[model samples]
Target chain A: MKKVGIVTGGTTKFTKTDISIESLLVSAIKQIFDNSSNLSQKDVDVVLTSTNANNKYLANITSELSGMAPKIAHSVESLCNSGTNCIVSAYAYISSGLADVALVAGAEKTDSPGLVLDWDKSRGQYKHPIYWSSMFTSAHKRKFGTTLEDLAYVGANNHRNALDTPYAYFEKPFSVEEIMESKPLTENLRLLDCSMPCNGSAAILLASENVIKNFCEQPIWMTGIGQKAISASFTKNDDLTSMKSTILSASDAYKMSKKAAEDIDAAELHDAFSICEIIELEDLGLVPKGEGGSYVRRLYDTKDRKINPRGGLIGTGHPLGATGIAQTIEICQQLQGKAGKRQIDGAKTGLIHNMSAAATSSTVLILES
Target chain B: MNKFEQELRNGNFVCGECSKCNKLVWPPSDLCNNCFNNVKWRPISKIAKLVEFSSKNDEYFCIAEFENQIRVMGKVENILNLHVGQTLTLVKCGFDGKEIFVFGLGD
Candidate 1:
């Protein structure tokens, strides 16, 4: 198989503003054309749109709006991780020589139907994500003695980091005390611990090694990709203290990339909720098991930008389908030395973790400059 | 509604057990996940062990496992010093656009 690389990417500001999904996707795609010096509609051989919206023929619609007619066009829907799923499809097309250049765009509306997994009857009346997150929190606390303060630090740090992220939904940071006092969604979860569903879109241009330099002066290589789905039902996740899918996917990603967690200079974790970050830190091998709380405490205490530098889902706003693509864009920018204030100094490699439906499924990507 | 919903609607918690492999199919599917064989429906045990729980506005909800395989989230009643691995009896269950499972500890 041939090599694939990310040539350029663009994202619209995440907000609660009402916008058409088609328009949101086009807005982000337009940025790719505006930013890339030599990229044109004709150069794109594949167009894949990712969103939870019920709209039909979205990829074709996006391509028409963006003035592109590609050999391959379709949509990818896997709930929260749809963005990366779309990018992965594009990577497959480029690497397999089916296509040399691919355009991947993802977007979501604030009221997108992807928020709830209604089909998972195992969830019963507790279908909303918070219920599942609460269970995870309760178990993690029981297993690791993770305090509410540790959860609060995850929120506080991400919100603080968002202040420097221009496209993030939150403009202000909340103190740890304030986050602790934020409206209680459950006994173990607070309103601030959850990510806000908002309107946003992100687009990325992928090309084979042969043509990547034509679109980007500094290309970020997609070295490794890993994805796993344990089950669609949330209850099938037997281990609440950790995301099993994340662990398995991260292991595969590390093996494929020939790199360990230590090689990840910067990372964008799937902090859909506060406890999620703590668990993901441990499950991804970034920190020792049962030590995620302390590791995050250290990151917060030292104001480190190594994790979720783009503010993660909690502070950046989660637009579901757009989330994974946006996360990949953050790491790309980090590796490209263009993340500005959120940049980790001298970052040469980065990781992006995205999951769907209560961590029942996950996708991990390892990228290098 | 499918067989699962219909059963819950009638206040009977039934699950599909594979006829070929004797595997219990959860979330109530007609086809067994293990062997792809037809399944027979049977009432699940009312007694369940608590997996985990949390409260919303003083109202507790929890995950309950039955037969060591089936698990579902439901509202907990008669909560008196509840803890994980503790057993609770399913007092009531139903379906009204949403599956509802109610577990109780005491009369």
Candidate 2:
């Protein structure tokens, strides 16, 4: 119950054209300078980092450019929720008076060590439970009518949204038919069904009312955050598609934010597949169950509330660990009224909900400017 | 395999955890959604339901119910046109683990 919250420090520049997970992060810190109007990187106290790539070397990279190294620099591994997790962890530290000025950053270069490296080979965050393979999904496909196209619809739609995002990976638009015709990775899930692998980084600086006044002018407020975990037995689950993680996470986020699902004006959902978003809409309560996909189609057909708005993972890119933080960046951008062309009109409140392990791990955050 | 026996034995079940929300999950953690904390390590259950199923040459798993709220989605367990509620066990589970579950069609 500590008075823990984040300030909207700034948003910097990044583009896949020459995207460096490290550089993006460096630029993000530079933003503290650009928007703070007076603060210097030397004014920061500590640093927190998150990523899901073989590039565990980023810690050295972030500190290199910022000039002054922090007292503590570490990495978090939460698949997609690392950003929010970093923020939450920072909130805990700040609220406790552990650090006055903290910088939270996330970035990943999925372009290296291709994602094909499965869980069994992982050392730190690499060890995965059984059923982490495409074989399991493939097995289901052999028995069901499910096809890769079902997954591609999400990628195509996400990419369509990415067309508007300058930082997105595949900014070019794609059609459902093109995605369907693309290469297959696993059963039902095509290469397109999966999130695009790319390189990018995002960073946010947090300050107490004391330190922040000297550095930030328009600090993006960290309004509410929550996290949860479930037992990790896939077969023991009652429903494969029903996300207990999402509902449970939202349960905490909604309670903390004092808001309902209906109140969220915009969202940045981790759409690893076309269906991921469809199911997420229902899981997040933005849409009714079963009808989620239909609503996606409806929205796409009309080109209205393009969910990813910034072109989702399908369009922008899915740098594993980076996606979650990037999603937060998008949410922060939306709430701060700086999303420009892709901005959700009058977006006073927003959320970034990402899932991992086929909807097992979830993270939800409610943001306000 | 006998009904209860297959439900108890047979093998080949998937397990996972919902790190996002702390829900006891069956299909392991490629994703944990509790406030979207990111996927993490947790105990996953090899247990599940056949709920109500059907037979077909094609594989599929789907179920849409209005029991409590709105529940829909299914799967095709490989080559089997598994009857509704057919208990299944994993012959192979993950990189090094497995368990069993009830598909749940009591016939």
Candidate 2: docking tier = incorrect
Write down the worst ten-residue block by lDDT for model 1 chain A.
A210-219
lDDT of 2 by residue, A60-176 (tens): 667777786776677777765666677777777777787777777776665544243243211111222212323333333344333455555566667777777776667477788
Cα lDDT, model 2, residue A132: 32
Every model: Cα RMSD to truth? 1.0, 8.8
Error of 2 at A244 (Å): 0.8
Candidate 2 TM-score, true structure as reference: 0.72
Return the TM-score for each candidate structure: 0.99, 0.72
Candidate 2, residue A320: lDDT: 65
Q: How high is the CA lDDT of each candidate model?
A: 0.94, 0.59
Q: Let me know the TM-score candidate 1 reaches against the reference structure.
A: 0.99
lDDT of 1 by residue, A1-369 (tens): 988999889999999889999999999999999999788899999999999999999999999988999999999999999999999999999999999999999999999999999999888899999999999999999999999999999999999999998999999999999999999999999999999999999999999999888888899999989999999999999989989999899999999989999999999999999999999999999999999999888999999989999899999999999999999999999999999988899999899999999999999999999
Q: Which residue pairs in candidate 1 collide?
A: none
